[model samples]
Target: MIEESQPGPGETPPALAVSGLAKRFDDVQAVDGADFIVRPGEVFGFLGPNGAGKTTTIKLLTGLARPDAGSIAYFGADFTRRLKAAQHLFGVVADGNNLYPELTGRENLEFCAALYGIGRAEARNRVEELLERFGLDYAAGRRFGGYSRGMGRRLCIAAALVHRPRLLFLDEPTTGIDVPNAREIRRMLAGLAADGTTIFLTTHYIEEAERLCDRVAFIVAGRIVRQAAVEKLLDGARDRRIIELQLDTAPEPLLSALSEHFPTNRWEPRAGKRLRLISTAEIELAPPVAFLAERGAAVLEARRLRPSLEEVFVEVTGLAAERLSAEKGGRRG
Candidate 1:
């Protein structure tokens, strides 16, 4: 239930608002006429394929780059004129290294604290607390140059929160990390959201965003195609049904019978005797399952899978995931 909150005669503005946000670099329109309102203390996800201008939109909001059109208001103030003063209200962590490689992790945190003008004692205490909280206490004395990618990511997040900014920007904060570390990061983010932090995260990891964000904005080719609650997106997806089956033996007759039972379900062969199935947007799994059971077929496993965010991404963009995967591989190569 996203109710629109109208402004009173004298009231504080929204936490953040972007209206007609458009940006261009020469002939390329990186962003186009984007408008959205981010309520305070909400976890917002930015979803887009590669080269879709998601990163560019982040830059415009953070004042790292200017927009050719539209206006951004932060904390009820003009974003351009008050950019410096808003720094205390803004915290950011983007992909790639943003810390000094020569400095130890503790030293890196201290430097950030100094930039935010915290006193030495307070800075030291905060650094220690964050290092412990992020499980980086063991690496606090190690130079960032020697840290693994996951360690670097953890330290970056810790540094971003040193000033306790009300709004946080995270761009692929868990990229290139193992599942355990990524899971920890997700938990930490949920905690922050619980503590009234307004988080805007941009990521290619659909599952991560689906788990962390309350609402998501799906962008394609510099334009927003969808914005809604995570549950709503899943409920609205064109591919919202998946059936899992375990069979005693892999039999063509059984497969044929199952296909005939639900002609609309997309059957996908898996390893062993397992089979995965998909269905159209309008169909429900209950009827299909009952039909199979009545036909005297032994049902091993059947459940509904909410639409994967990746499917939503592909549906909105009309581009296959492999294309984006190839682009990422090319960048690495």
Candidate 2:
């Protein structure tokens, strides 16, 4: 018998919850009945294409935009009704640089501290520590407008953390960051989760989501197509592997043997005189390899290809991963 999965020990009314969430812009339905639970200290990854309502959902959860339908709950409290009080529950870093230009990075953080009612001395110390952690200490004294894109992003993150929020909303947190800075940011996010901070983030990078998220939700055309624990998805894909064989010419007998042995498996043509075969864990390749050797087929490479997050996304959404790349390109253009 199958049992429903219950929330884990650390989850209590969820760190964040959205039920029947929907949003609209004129006639277009931007988000449709989205529901998810984010547990305390878990990194929940939200993924989708450009017009997939990811940013809209983030705005609603962060209270930047009001939802047309549905409710948001945080720690057993109503999120929309307790907007002011709920402000202290989260830190947010939006995709854009909505920072103060005239003020230095230190000054921006101090301003945020003041807004959070943090004492001057405590805020100053925290700001100093954050600067050191993000490797922005050298540029802390420089005006934010004069800082590089990466530095500005770091400053924005520091400002968001001024109040020591229990949850963090990171929208494209590594967008303007360099490779090293991106790694550092990922490390910092991991540390925050380790210390009991729930993180809700949206990223287009599949590998980043696979590395950072305990579970992920795939959104498309304003709806979530599927969600599961990362391990479960990978394990399911691992049960099936793809094997590609290169032959000088079409080996009829070997192909016939493969068809006979693995009737349920799929066979397709690969570029440059190669035949691709897909089989499940139950099928052993040793016999097939021997058959190929006898048929004068040379083994160029034999390896099991595990499905990636991108492949899973494509399978679920019936859309190309290239959509994300196109979105990034359009943004750049």
Candidate 3:
């Protein structure tokens, strides 16, 4: 088991702390000046577009790659000089499989346990327990190479937990998996968080982060753009309301009136007689509705659009999540 730090009076050390972190690969500054603190038992999410240094940040935190400049502290202890000693305090589920393919599912877990110096009898019990916990009991005897993608991912997670780490670093755990399997993994993660495991998750899926993260940090161009509690970000974005209006006539007149009456609001025309109005400040729909009515334009529909985490992400990062995904995909192709 990991040892807890004796924090000073009125001070609680963060589960993980990073300041001014930076890493470079040849010509690229993959991670630059990244900083964040994760409180104990909190599900912290690291979000960014592809090549935005999400993976590099994880590498630095988990000690896979050394940072060019920064201080990394965990539970009030500086782990820079003693990375190996700190290994037992945290676990990592990398983006790709990192297990022996020739071994059976149960054998993989047992091997991981043995590496942690677990006794033979205790390792046997731990392996069995994890197999059941991850829903791999029946397939425990199957070779890992023959397991499905989802099953392999689940077994890898179980192997990471063999030592019961205090901090779990999950790097895109649900990416490329089937929907049902992804849901199961997410459910399991939620249960782990409820039981007080600090999770550090990295993902490109904004909706997944919206549902799972207590706090989220957005990184862009190798730097952290923003970090805040999920609720606070969503609540703050509530001020910026989007209203979509459908009119029988052309939107040129209504668009002009919007500029005259509500100059601060942004108005754009959409296909099929649709006018979208975006306001950074809270405003009633009555004014816009009345303006359109006065212009003899038949108002077919006018409704307020509920703010979503994706909108907030776009507002902060200046790029739509879908566009980012496409760009990443094109580069890969």
Q: What is the C-alpha RMSD of each candidate to the true structure, in Å?
A: 6.2, 5.7, 6.0
TM-score of 3: 0.81
Q: Give per-residue CA lDDT, model 1, range 205-312, as digits (tens).
A: 677778899888877788887777777777767446766666444534456776877787766544556655666755565675565556555557765555676566
- Candidate 3 structure quality by residue, lDDT tens digits, 1-333: 011212346767899988789999999999988778888899998888888998889888888889899888888898865667789999999987789999999989999999999999999998999899899999999999999988999998999999999999999888777778888899889988998999999988887898899989888879888888889889977877888899999897567767888898877665568887778887678877888888898779888888767677877887755655454322110
The model with the greater TM-score, 1 or 3, is 3
Clashing pairs in 2: none
Candidate 2: 10-residue stretch with minimal lDDT: 1-10
TM-score winner between candidates 1 and 2: 2
All candidates: TM-score: 0.78, 0.80, 0.81
- Best-performing candidate as measured by TM-score: 3
In Å, residue 28's CA in model 1 sits off its true spot by 1.6
